[model samples]
Target: MKFSPHAWAKLIYLRDRGTTEVGGFGITDPGQPRFVKDIVLVSQSCTEITVAFDDTAVADFFDDQIDAGRHPEQFARIWIHTHPGRSAEPSGVDHETFARVFGNCDWAVMFILARNGATYAELKRTGNPHSEPLSVGIDFRDEFAGSNQAVWEGEYLRCVQAAPMPPIWDLDLLPGDEPYLSEQWPWLPI
Candidate 1:
């Protein structure tokens, strides 16, 4: 999805916080780990979401953003966070929090930072305890990584299986369109 400038700013803001680990809790999935990148509220309605840092300061920041009354919705909340050394999977704590807070709204967004590398975002559909993964596509390219840069850019959907460990993919490869690595993050850059 194309993000607004506000969303981009939020992502940069989170990165600037420079935390090794970050998370959030709200009406929904409080404990679930979210690697926030950016967020957007149009006229008080929660329609757009970006990324941001995981810090205690976020609650106040959100409140202030909403209080400014710049959007279409009367009230809005956006949550973001970081994952320094661990994978983006929701921990046990996250599961409990999600179960508790999710009742507050019709929808919520969750973002997960992958160590120092990439970020993952999920648009959660409230109501059903179990739901399908919403796919989000991002474009990211670093000249230092060689041709693999474009390969790493594409669509990512929520994984239904158990969360995997870090270094989510093996970097080793042979010359081919398909990744030589046996397992890979569906959302990771090709």
Candidate 2:
């Protein structure tokens, strides 16, 4: 599934913000770094994808959006967020999170960014034990201004010009529970 222009903009915006913080989303605890989970992108074309954050702020953002009535169906949830020292591939924590949440949705999107600015995005289908890397290709019509650069799927370059961003979903809160997916990433078995 390809991301829309608007969604790409949001991902870039969040990436910029994440660049400043050690792990992203402002969690400074050494043992409790930030992560994202349960994200959704409702696009007019293709499948409306949901991104699940292994990180807390990402999840909270979705909750806020839902409270604001942005996403009504909450059809699919994509799991996304950054990996500070690792690649964008799903970790053990990611596997466990997917196992627990995969039953609720049809797709998953994962965004991994290194500390030095290298980034990668992945889209996964439910019940699929693996996450596929999304090849990102950038197109620049004007060489002088880097702002005009457009990102596209490397495999399908002509599709569009865009980037990736964090998405929020409208999910209902279960009773008597704090959000299981929190900003502080509690390491769980895959």
Candidate 3:
């Protein structure tokens, strides 16, 4: 998939700015949903290996985007995230979350950017549970906006809540207790 230069730079900056994973939705051109023009982050809690987006924050993002006259296809179809490690390969959690969360949509894209500059992208569509691999690249041909570090930093600070992975003992759950993980990562199956 093609990303505008500004969006590509922003994703790289966000990826390098932290040791934990960070995720956001891609804003694409209305006419060309595969061509991402920007990235919009929602409030989320992050550990080294996981990123849990806040449901309320996602709702607010939808409302704000609609108010601005953008369609859902423009703002919600592409999921962009960073992998803090060298491999951009999707982990089991990533696969499960992608399937459960974006499965119902007519089409969607999941893109991963890694710290070591590796990347992975795939497109999923209704009726096709199997994802089609996509090439990732920056589209410099577009008249892209320059990076705005201050704004990006502000957004990162406002939306990303980095947290340590809770130890197993710290969970303190009895056998019959509801799975706490399902709550923190609502998109994952219990």
Using lDDT as the measure, which candidate wins? 3
Q: Provide the overall lDDT of each model, using Cα atoms, as 2-decimal numbers.
A: 0.35, 0.36, 0.83
| Per-prediction CA RMSD (Å) | 14.5, 15.6, 7.0
State candidate 1's TM-score: 0.43
Tens-digit lDDT track for model 2 on 100-152? Answer: 75545565544554434456566566677676766653322323222322331
TM-score of each: 0.43, 0.38, 0.87
Query: Candidate 2's C-alpha lDDT?
Result: 0.36
Q: Residue by residue across 1-190, what tens digits does model 3's lDDT show?
A: 8988999889988888888889999998779989988998999998756788999999999999999999999999899888776667776677778878888899999898878888889999888867799998788985777789999999999999999875654333211113333433444334
User: Could you give candidate 1's per-residue lDDT for residues 83-116 as a string of tens digits?
Assistant: 4433555433334444455446566655554454
Residue 125 deviation, candidate 3, in Å? 0.8
- Model 2 lDDT, residue 91, Cα: 44
Once fitted onto the true fold, the runs of candidate 3 whose alpha carbons sit more than 4 angstroms away are 166-190
Candidate that beats the other on TM-score, 1 or 3, i.e. the better one = 3
Report the lDDT of model 3 for residue 109.
Answer: 91
